[model samples]
Target: MTENKIIIKLDKDKKKELEKRFSQIGLSMNDYINLALNQFLIQGKVPFEIKSPSYDISTLKTKKAMLKTEEEDIGIIKNSISNSDN
Candidate 1:
């Protein structure tokens, strides 16, 4: 993988806040930034899966996207019905 440099400007207070948060989560500033980048590229969301005390980290990491619920699928059905009704 090609490594690149990115320079970001943050206010002093914001930088301090970010450093504290990252330290609390056991991630260095670099690692936290990389995690954010990976989330943006891989899943397009942060905190991708639910965190559970019973589940291992690997299990949580491996969780797939949830299957669409029946209610979610009803949109297509409703659209078709509306078109036919017209």
Candidate 2:
């Protein structure tokens, strides 16, 4: 298979940050970018959505609150069961 090269410019800081993230995920920058491009070509769009950290933190808080509410409800149900058994 013939190979082609593509060149693009990025901010140095952003490139460094992307390299760090790619390293953490055990992929080289070249491989990661190529995978993304291949996916975009096949799907006709970027494969993933970029989300803000604040959004992620808010979602986490919401999930925790829901879990706490469910736990409280379970405790109330258990108490009612025991009370009825008396």
Best by lDDT: 2
lDDT of 1 by residue, 1-86 (tens): 89999998999999999899989989888998888788878886764566775487666555522223333465522322243555
> What lDDT does the true structure give each of the candidates?
0.70, 0.84
Per-prediction count of colliding residue pairs?
Answer: 0, 0
RMSD each, Å: 13.5, 8.0
Candidate 1: stretches off by over 4 Å = 45-86
Weakest ten-residue segment in model 2 by summed lDDT: 76-85
> How well is each residue in 1-86 modelled by candidate 2, as lDDT tens digits?
89989897999999999899999999989998889999999999999998887679888899877787787687843322244555
Q: Which predicted model would earn the best TM-score?
A: 2
